[model samples]
Target chain A: MDIDLILKAINITVIGYIIVFVVLFLLYLSFYYLAKLLESQAKERCRRAGKNKCAEHDKFSVDSDTTAAIAMALYLHFGETHDIDSTKLTMKRESKRYTPWNSKIYNVIHRL
Target chain B: MEGLYRFLEYTGFANFTFGHGIMIIVGLVFIFLAIKKDYEPLLLVPIGFGIILGNIPFIQNAGLNLGVYENGSVLRYLYFGVLSGVYPPLIFLGIGAMTDFSTLISNPKLMLLGAAAQLGIFATFLGSIFLGFNLNEAGAIGIIGGADGPTAIFLASKLANGSNGNLNLIGPIAIAAYSYMALVPVIQPPIMRLLTTKKERVIRMKPPRSVSKVEKIIFPVAGLLLTGFISPASLPLLGMLFFGNLLKESMVTERLAETARKPMIDIVTILLGLTVGASTQADIFLTKQSVLIFILGALSFMVATAGGILFAKFMNLFLSNENKINPLIGSAGVSAVPDSARVSQLEGLKYDKNNHLLMHAMAPNVAGVIGSAIAAGILMSFLL
Candidate 1:
C-alpha cells in the first residue's frame, strides 16, 4: 500500500466521523434549547389562561408512570375480546338488483 | 427450413449461458424471500422480478435495445434516475413526510447514537482501501455500513458513477445495502446480544414529552439550515427530506404531504427497485469484487451495531441509574429506520415484557438517517 494513500484514508475517516458527530451534536443542543423555550412559553400561556385551563395544559406532560397507569386502566376496561375489523369495506353483489330499466317485462313489451 | 433456422438463432435457448441460469435462480430466490419470508417485500418483489426480466438472454448488439445497459431501453431510462442520483432524494422526501420527529425532538441525546453508528461507515472505508479498491470505490462501498439503501445508492451513484474508467458499482452496492437492510432483524440481534447484559437490555427509559405544534413546525427549517450549511453536498437529499417534512408539519400543506408520502413515494420505489435489480445483468454483476463488497457490507453492519451499543453503554457511565438508556436501543443507530428500532423493541421484550422501547428507539433511528446523509456528503466532498 502507498504511504500517501493510507494517510489520506485515515485523514478522511477522522474528519468524516468528526463532522457527523458535530452536526448531530449541534442538532441535539438546538432541540434541547427549543424544548426549554417551548416549555417556558407553555407555562406563561397557561398562567394567562386561568387555573382550570392550566390544569388541562398539564395533561400533555404526563410522566411515564401516569402513562403506564392509563394504559393499564384502558387494558383492564377493554379486555382482549374486542371485535376485529379489518377496516376494509367490501361490497359483494349477491345478484344484480332488479331495476325498472332492466325489467324483463318492460324490455319485452316495449311499453313506450 | 431456412426461415425456421433463423428464428431459432434469436431464441433464448440459443442465447442462454451458465451465467444467465445462475442469475435467474438468484432472482427467483429474491422473489421467494420477499413473498414467503416477508423480508422488505415492497423492495425485494420488484427487484426480484426485474432480475428475471434483465437476465432473459438476448443476442448482443443486435439493435434490440432490450438490456438495461443498452441505449434507448426503457429500463435504462428509468435507471438514469438512479445513475444521476435523482431517485434516492425523492424517496427521502417520502420518508420525511411519513416520519414523525417528535420522539427525536423530545429526547435529543439519542442522536449521538446515530452519530456513533456511523463508525461503521468510516471503518469500512479503511477496510476497503486496505482491500485494494481505489479511494472513490471504497467510499461508495463504505456507505453500506450506514444500512440506508437510498444513501448507499445516492453516494454510489455520485462517487462511483462509473465515469473516468471507474467500475460502475451502483448495482452491486445498492443490492448489498438493501439486502443488509432487509436482514436487519437477522444481522443486528446477535451483535446486540453480544454487547449488552440482560440488565442493560431490561432498562426502561422514560416516555417522551409531547412536543408543541410550533416546535414541530420550526424543526425542519432549522434542520435544513443547520445540516445544509455543515454539509452542502448533502443538500440535494437533505433539502428534499426537510422540505417534505415541512409540508407535513405545516398543517396547511396536508394535501401535498399526503401526495409526497403516499402515491409519489410508491411510484419512485417501484422504479428504483426494478431498475436497480435489472442493472444486475449476469455478465456485468457477478464478479469477485461483488463478493468482496458483500463481505465488507456485512462487516460494516456488525461494526455499526457494536458502535451504537458501546456508545450507549459509555453514555450510561455519565447518566444516573434512573436515567440510563437501554443499550439494545443503541442498535437502532444504524439508518435502517423503524426496522432497527423494531429490533430493539423485540429484543427488549425478550428480556422484559411491558417495556416498550419503540418510541425511544425512534429518536436514534431517524437521526441515523440524517447522520448517514451527512457522512455521504463528507465522503463525496473528500473522495469525489
Candidate 2:
C-alpha cells in the first residue's frame, strides 16, 4: 500500500524490461545476420547444384494457392496413393546428418 | 445397530462439510469445462478429480488415511512433488524437448516483445500490494502474468511460504494461472483487438528465414549463457529447458528428446496437475485474498497481452512497410505457447485468411516463456 512500494514495483518493471530487451536485442543482431549468412550460403550451394535442383529454395515466397494447386494436381494424378520407393531419374548429393527434411523435426512445425 | 452407526460415521456422508461440498462442485465444474469446452482437458481432468480426492473428508492421521492433508497418505507423497519443487523443472525439460526454437531463432527481434509483456507481472505486483497483500504474496500473485503454471508454482512455493512453513497461497495462485492459460482463447483476443487496429491485424509478416541445424544446436547453449548470466536463480528452470533443447538439437539424442517430450512430460504433468488440484481445498482456496489474487491475475494477463501488442505496434513505427510486423502477433508474447499464438492466428484469419500469423506469433510466444522465467528469477532474487 505504500507509495514507495509502488515505485519499487514500477522500477522493477522498467529495469526488467530493459534488461530482457537488451539481451534479446543482442541475440537478434547476432542471429539475424547469422541466418542471413547461412541463407546466402545455402542459396549459393543451391545454385552450384544447378538451376533445376532447388528452384524453390530461392523462391521461398510461393503462394499458398500455388502450393494448394500443386498439392491438388499431385492428389489427382496419384489418386491418394504412391509407392514409397518408386524409381525416378534423380541424382544424389552426399548424405548429411541434418537436412531440413531428414532431421525429422519439421513434421512438428508448419514451415509455410 | 452400533456397527452400522460406526460404518455410517466412517463413511464420508456423515463427516462432509458445506465447504467440502462447494469444493466438490468446483471440481465438477472444472471437469465439465474440460470435457464440454475442451479447455486444457489434460490438465483440468486430473486436477478436477484430484480436487474431489482432496475434499473427501476423512479422519486425520489415521490408518484409513485418504485425505491429502493427512500424514502417511498416498496423496501426501504425491503432493511432495509440488512441495519439493521437482515436477516443474521436469515439465520444463519436456517443454524444451518438444519446443522448436526455430521461430525464435528466425526472428530474434520478437524476443523483445516477450520481454515487453512481463509488464503484467510487475503491474500486478503493485496491484496486489495496493489490494492489501504483503510483499511476498504480491510477488506470488504477480507471476500469474507469466501465464505459465510451473513458474507460478515455483515462485509461490518459495515466496508465499511463511516463516512457520505455511504454503497458504500456492493453491489459488496455481489455479488462477492455469485458469487464465485455459482461457487464452477468451482473455487474449479482446485485449489484442482492443490494442490494435484492423489494418495492423491484417498486416502480413514475411515468413521467417529457414534455420540451419548448427544454429539450432548452438542456440540453447548461447541462450543458456546469456539468460543464466542475467539471472542465476532462473538456472534450474532455464537449465532444464536448455538441456532438453540440447538433447533435441543434438540429433544423436533423439531417443532422449522423445522420452523427455513424451513419457517424462506426461508423468510430470499428471502429478503436477493432480497435486495442484488437491492443494486447492476450500479452506485454503476460498479466502478473500484468493479472490483478490484471481482478480489481479486476470488483470495481469490483460496487461501482458496489451503490452505485447502495443510493443509490436511501437516497433512497427521503426520498421519499413515491407518489414512491418502484425501487431496481433504481439499478444502471443504471454508465453501461453500454441494457444495464444493460435488465438493470434484465428484473429488474423478473421481479418484476412491469407495472413497466417501462427509461425510469426510463435516467436514471441516461446520468447514469452523465457521472458516470464527470467521475470520469475528476478522476482525470486528480490523477494526471496
Instruction: Return the lDDT, model 1, position A75.
Output: 88
Runs in model 2 deviating more than 4 A are A36-112, B1-3, B61-64, B162-167
lDDT by residue (tens digit), candidate 1, A8-68: 9999999999999999999999999988888888889989888788888777676655765
TM-score (0 to 1) of chain B for each candidate: 0.99, 0.97
Model 1, residue B186: distance off in Å is 0.6
lDDT for B89 in candidate 2 is 90
TM-score for candidate 2, please give it.
0.86
- Quantify all predictions' global Cα lDDT against the true fold: 0.92, 0.85
Writing each residue's lDDT as its tens digit, candidate 2 over A21-101 gives: 776677678788888888778879988998875787866664434544675699798985766766787888864445665
Cα lDDT tens digits for candidate 2, B1-384:
999988888877887888889989989998999999999998889888888878887655557867666678788899878877788899999999999999899778898899888888888987887887777788889999989999899888788854444447878998899888999999988788788887788898876766779899988998899889988888889999999999999999999999999999999999989988998777767778888888999999999999899999999999999889999989999998789999988999999976777788899999998988888888888777
TM-scores of the candidates are 0.90, 0.86
lDDT of 2 at B168: 70
Q: Where does model 2 sit among the CAPRI classes?
A: acceptable
Clashing pairs in 2: none
